[model samples]
Target: MKSRFTPLLAGLVLAVSSLTVQADEVQVAVAANFTAPMQKIAAEFEKDTGHKALLVFGATGKLYAQIKNGAPFQVFLAADDKTPAKLETEGDTVSGSRFTYAIGTLVLWSAKPGFVDDQGEVLKKGAFKHLAIANPKTAPYGAAAVATLTQLGLLDAIQPKLVTGENISQAYQFVVTENAELGFIALSQVMADGQMTGGSAWVVPSNLHDPIRQDAAILAKGRNQPAARALVEYLKGDKAAAIIKSYGYAL
Candidate 1:
């Protein structure tokens, strides 16, 4: 009986050892707009692959700056394709590791229900005193907001009422806190399971602005990290794609 138990114990120990050796951690820098979906994806990724994703969220430009300054992030999920392409050109990312993970949708959101119309005529109506947007210089969603307003011929008219946040998260906060009447933000921020989680929102038409092709890549710092490589591949999987779509992002 003792000998039989000894072999079982040895097998269990070896299995546990194998699991420990297989698990790895990756530090990921993610765009602010992708916060909700990325969280879900990270959880699924860990469950499926036994690889942990340690995520940091920020504006794309700021994250790019941090990456350039040697931040420990091994993976980057940028708000736009351009930033990752620039990094690739600059040799900051692993060659051939970059891919577009999602296409983002911008929304005009108000914490108050029925405050924004489905057609997004609120900008032209100009009844609100303050409208929030992320700093266009550092956030692609903000840039898209600007583009939308421009396309609608409301930029000059709405400029005076603009309240800017450092990033999309902050812009969303401004609306949530009632500091601004409404804001331009990522659809993912206000959506879950193909419905608005709360408040009123106008899904900005895709043709109003440049397509927000969000991309991801393994950074040079993660070139040798298995977890980083795994994460890049995981984002392309059906589970991750479903989560992204559930957040109102296009795959």
Candidate 2:
């Protein structure tokens, strides 16, 4: 009986060893607004690293809460500099691994044809009854929306006509669903397949708001994970920067 069991035990050990060798998949927490580009980048990352990326996409604030609760995210790709800075202050990150991957843009987007215009002067004209924005308290895109309005001197004038989404991605959904005639959303949300959507958009002027410097950082969970660090460095490379630019983000 002992002799017969030896072969079975040896086979089980080999199977476990094989599985362990392929378990280098990195768990990444990405902002929801970055869903599209991150998908493309991950494909490239896998091709180069032979390590798969397990991406979790959502609002930066919500992801922050999840991380605080010990979610197994090995790294964070946040839409704002604030959250990553906070995490580092709290000692939740691997020291010296944080860096800005992209500068995001906010746009006044609409699904209805001819609704938006080149310079976005249509907002002052009040062509649409409602304007959409992400919740300014949590989503960085939301803050950009507010800044754009304030910079255009229309925030108070259009206060009553504003609708809000919990996150920038949801704000885009509001416009798509016609819940709001127009909403402020991340540029990537409307740029699909390397093209802009049907309606016109005025990419918000960068000077109107604080720069949306999207910071990526390795979590404490990935302290010794070279793949996580390599992934961050990979993003600064030519291929990844191209992916980032194709999505309407500035690297």
Candidate 3:
């Protein structure tokens, strides 16, 4: 009887192991500024870790609202540290699970070649008909853009020309589509291999605004999830860091 039971137990253990090895999908809410890098990280994560990350991109504030209202996302990659910290405080996230994954940089970019000056003198010149920026109320990058303008004492003057987008990705589109002459956007949106891929841009100085310390956290719904934890760890790994750095984000 003992010998027969031992074989049955071994078979059960093997079946459970096989189930664990099979990839599990984790739903992730990602900030728009991290779009390109997140896409790359998700592909690599699935390939190397046998876990699938189903990513949804949007403004951090909007994503936070969704989470508060019980969105089924297991992981959140925010564009700023504040939103994750807030979620942790609100008991919406797994405690002690939040960490800064990347430091984002902002840029003023335009579709027209040589339209934006490196020194950002174009803002003062104000020749363009429209200047696009993300909605500061919802997008951290947009808040940073506003902060930069305030620091330079140009907020009031630039307000008349302002065209706001719901998120940084849309703000970038406004400029790239030439709907707005120029726009404040994430450097990663228009950069490749640490250089501007097209048109001209002014890489905004870090001192101009608060550091965009992007953070990632596991949500309450994901507290018991192995696949969610795996994604959080994968984001801190060397491969993910390299992909993020290549997109102009600092690890």
Question: Which is the leading candidate under lDDT?
Answer: 1
**1-251 per-residue lDDT for model 3 (tens digits):** 78979989999999989977777999999999999989989999999978889999999999999998889999999999999998999899999899999999999999999999999999999898999999999999999999999999999999999999999999999999999999999999987767778999899999999999999999999998999999999999999989899889988
Model 3, runs deviating above 4 Å: 1-21
- What is the per-residue lDDT of model 1 for residues 1-251, given as tens digits with 9 covering 90 to 100? 78979989999999999999999999999999999999999999999999999999999999999999989999999999999999999999999999999999999999999999999888888999999999999999999999999998899999999999999999999999999999999999999998889999899989999999999999999999999999999999899998999999988
Candidate 1 ranges with C-alpha deviation above 4 Å:
none
**Distance from true location, Cα of 26 in model 1, Å:** 0.2
Cα shift from native, residue 171, model 2 (Å): 0.7
Candidates ranked by lDDT: 1, 3, 2
Candidate scoring better on lDDT of 2 and 3: 3
Better lDDT candidate (1, 2): 1
TM-score per candidate, chains pooled: 0.97, 0.88, 0.92
What is the TM-score (0 to 1) of candidate 3? 0.92
* Per-candidate RMSD, Å: 1.0, 4.1, 3.8
lDDT of 3: 0.94
Residues 102-215 of candidate 2 have per-residue lDDT tens digits of 999888788987778878988989967888898888888898889989998999999999998888878888899998988889999888656896776788889999999999
For TM-score, candidate 1 versus 3, the one ahead is 1
lDDT of each: 0.95, 0.88, 0.94
